[model samples]
Target: MIDFKEKVSETLSLRTGAEVTIEWRINIKGVMTGWCRLREAALILPAAEAVAGLEGRLSMITAYLSDSAKQKGVREIAFHFDLDGTTLTLGIELPLEGARIPSLTPLFRNADWHEREFMELYDIQVIGHPAPRRLFLDRSIDPAAFERLIPYSTFSNGANSKALWEKVMARSGNNRKELQ
Candidate 1:
């Protein structure tokens, strides 16, 4: 079977002279499962179209927006495609500063909600989204409030609980220094 990466690359090269770079992925068990990635976020539409032409089905789309992403100066969005019984993920990197990417909802119905979610949470504008409205957050909630919420890494029990307790105590002027 032709690897999805090669197929996607070849198909896209024929359609457009753009290059699609593939990075092989290894599962948790250390087994090389598949390869993924295509082009920058700006060129994602053409790469996605090529995958679609190969009879690939869009499974889901996810956006990773965090302090780390901001630090790296990248906005990574992954488009998961089921191509010929193999799962292929196309990751596109956009600039973190004032990020804007063309919406895929015009071509794929499944892209609607995913794009909206990214727009609301990450503050990355998805231009041309059909329903350009708040998905989870209403108007009352501050747009940047999403970032203030606890990140997955800091959401654990023991250490995070102690940190939270210390923070509250410090704010209430009941910290160790004040108590002393």
Candidate 2:
């Protein structure tokens, strides 16, 4: 019931000296959701602080490359926060070559997991993270596994077996044309 969209917008602008906008939507169930995109990547720190001041908890983080973004040569990372059952997402765009963002573990402990996941999967650098170690990925796997369009079989060699995916497809009665 705080209607944090305004407070967050004001806090971000006051702290970073940049105007921030948040779009809010209320579903039929009365749940509120907000989205905002920061002008600069460094502004996320102050933005996160504003949410933390409001007793918001970091819920999840996601990073990805969309077709349009890929054409633009940039990747995007979105940070989600849970504030009294309301959800707010703050997103930033990063260059594809050097995607780096500050770690939010200090303000939100659970951010450690989400940060690590994005680091390995998307080749993002969570600068200042306490322990920037691998969580799900093994050392053998290359970083930024999702950055390119590689075949699933090529990516998961140890997954099933040689041609196992094809075999499974055959067993499932699906053809390559149907899959394509």
Q: What's each prediction's clash count?
A: 0, 0
True lDDT of residue 15, candidate 2: 75
lDDT of every model, 2 decimals: 0.69, 0.83
Residue-level lDDT of model 2, residues 1-180, one tens digit each, is 454567767876787788878888899998989889998789989889888888889989989889899899898989999988989999999998887899899989998888888887897899899998877776667888887575676567547765666766866778665456
Best by TM-score: 2
Can you give the lDDT of residue 70 in candidate 2?
84
User: For residues 15-105, could you state the per-residue lDDT of candidate 1 as single tens digits?
Assistant: 5567655665656764443455555666777767777788877778878766787788887778887765566777777886777888887
Candidate 1: stretches off by over 4 Å: 3-5, 24-34, 66-68, 149-180
| Total clashes in model 1, counting residue pairs 3 or more apart in sequence or in different chains | 0
TM-score of decoy 2: 0.82
Please provide the root mean square deviation of candidate 2 (C-alpha atoms, Å). Answer: 7.4
TM-score of each: 0.69, 0.82
